[model samples]
Target: MGVTEYSAKKLYAHLGFANGRDTMVAEGYRMDVLHVWGTHELSTADLLEWLGEFSPQSVEWIDDSSCTLRCNIIMINESTVLHVLHKLAEPFDRRVALTAMAAVISTMNTHNNGGDFERALRPPKLSPVEGTSDRLMPPCGRWFKSISSPERALCLYLRIAHKG
Candidate 1:
């Protein structure tokens, strides 16, 4: 719908994942999907497919330009997408940055947890994207996290997803 959403969606599609929402990260979730927590591994091609399809906008690609994305822990059905992805592939490890594999209880402090205008902490104490808590978060559980705010650059893609 928007430039950022288009970029995210483009990234997902490029990763070979079925279109999420005709946009970026907010795309719809397909029923045929399957995942395993740190066990089921996907090829780098598949992972790349999923990330490349997301629309790219407002981002400049450079040989060394990179951003560390922090996401909350997430669990869907029987697997942890982020964890497994990172565990299964060496490229994934470079793709994601968790800093730690364990969740810290202090992230829920609210006072310092993201504060009023800061980016959300990884393994978020409370992940509004997944509508769940990160009490026992792991490094590989970042896949299911996404902000739902349309105004936020990171969450803008989710806003265009199908309202399940």
Candidate 2:
């Protein structure tokens, strides 16, 4: 769940995984898992900065308009999915973390298709939208939502999935 030092959108789409930024051309390795922040409001620069550092082989599907997703893999890896889920809590809702994590597990694909991403837009547990958002996203969760806790829930889901 720990994101490395790479927040550039260029890194996310540099591989041209499919539906990536126009700046990217050639395709890179698709991911084995994916995490779509469908409702998260991200600036072009911010999106690029965060996604730019992806391993290309880490994502499987995307809801990114300015931020799409794609991935490659034989089977879904619980740890990989859980890792990404835990990272999504930052600047986003906590209750929705579980929902978002589930969505990622539900939407892993090689081709970049942002289907039914709106479901992720709503704030988790009735949380108000943050004032500092770079873009307009639907509100989710309570204002007091803790970031790390939600990630932990996602991790739980992944652990269960791993066991199953």
Q: How many clashing residue pairs appear in each of the predictions shown?
A: 33, 30
Give the whole-model CA lDDT for all candidates, comma-separated: 0.28, 0.33
For residues 52-106, what per-residue lDDT tens digits would candidate 2 score against the true structure?
4433232332233212223311123423432443353323335667788767755
lDDT tens per residue, model 1, 1-164: 12354544443443445454333334544221222122113332332333332311112111121111111111231122332232222222212444332233245444465564344434567536552223123323224333221121221111111113
RMSD of each: 17.7, 17.3
Model 2, CA-based lDDT: 0.33
- Mind sharing the TM-score for model 1? 0.18
**Model 1: how far residue 43 lies from native, Å:** 33
lDDT of 2 at 25: 23
Clashes of 2: 30
Query: Can you tell me which runs of candidate 1 are displaced by over 4 Å?
Result: 1-9, 13-95, 99-135, 139-144, 149-164
